[model samples]
Target: MRKAIVRVADLRQQVYDNLKERITRGEFPMDHKFQEISLAEELGVSRTPVREALALLVRDRILVQAVRGFRFPEFGPEEIVEITEIRLRLEPYAVRLAVEVLSAEKRTALAGLIRGEIARHGEADTWVAAHRRVRAALFAPVRNKRLIEAIAHYEDTIHFMRVNTLQDARWRGLSVGGSAKLADAIEAGDAGAAEAAQATLLGLARDSFLAWSAENA
Candidate 1:
């Protein structure tokens, strides 16, 4: 906790990467507040780098400034719908591209990941991790960096909701089925089927998330 990061050149980026990992891993509770001073102390770095990292996270919409510090941003209904619309448009096409170009060996690998997703339904964490791996594998054949980056940006922006959405047992089951469909479509080299499966996958995810948001609201 007290050791400084050895990489001086990318100090700011290191800080950003570390904080982002913690956020994505659900380490910080909602009640926990982040300040430059405490973050620098925790990371054994100067306040300047910590400040810059926090600024970047805010700019990326990963966090929002609070009265005294930064906290995870809470998306409202409108923002959630907008994000869903964008993802629905982008991901299906990406999956189609991936299916069209996916190698047979990589298709086999993707099928393995999806099988794990179907089998690891015991705990939410394990299931979520498996699902994430399959999602990444689904994009392995995508050669377009910009398209992949765009998909990642929206996914990152709603990362918290995506994680929580899988906690619903029914949705998790649906997700596994959808992932299986994606694998089948990819294995068959049916770009059209892959695209349709991807749309269904994203739609189910969005609906579950919207349900959770509505209930929580």
Candidate 2:
């Protein structure tokens, strides 16, 4: 019975990952309602797993309860600003911790990842993946598991908004440049410069989101 329960839990996690990937890729329209029956049918799964996955996503703030079911929450300027504030506080501290603990080899590896992403300018998905690797490198040395988990959770929650913002070529270019600068600072073991680079990156992102929101509003 324990083995059977473990298999079911694993299946539910798989469903959750698949749905999260779809949402991140913008396959589902923002604010579109989700139906557990339809999703289960599409994925060739049962409603129990789909229902459980949806509940997990709702807890992650990636999905919210709607009148009928769940919908992806639309982020506005204010929401973006709030996310930015949290990122600015949390990320720079992470960078500082990273600089203190990262070995020279790890720094070199991080630089390589940043350069690779910079070379792949127009491919949003690849760039985002590489960017994530860079972040993981920085956070790898942090001893506090809970802080690292919080950072990862925040990143997942804002995944869609970040991807949508990168859809703008100009913003994408600026983002790559910021990453390059950040990588350089980290490689040099300059904590202050790394923190500054993180601030610049988040500041540009915050400004871009606010501008887009104002224009749309």
Computed on alpha carbons, the lDDT of every model, listed in order, comes to 0.82, 0.80
lDDT of 2 by residue, 1-217 (tens): 4555343347789999999877865677565789998999999999998999999999999998888889877787778889889989888888888887888888777777777767874356456555656677768888988888888887878777566667777777888888889889988989899889998988987887777667766
lDDT of 1 by residue, 20-102 (tens): 87776566765578999988888999999999999999988889999998988988878888898999899999988887786
Which ranges in model 2 have alpha carbons more than 4 Å from their true place?
1-9, 122-126
Worst 10 residues of 1 by lDDT: 120-129
Pairs clashing within candidate 1? none
TM, every model: 0.89, 0.87
Give the candidate number with the greatest lDDT.
1
For candidate 1, give the lDDT: 0.82
Cand. 2 TM to true fold: 0.87
Q: What is the lDDT of residue 125 in candidate 1?
A: 55
Give the distance in Å from residue 3's predicted Cα in candidate 1 to where it truly belongs.
29
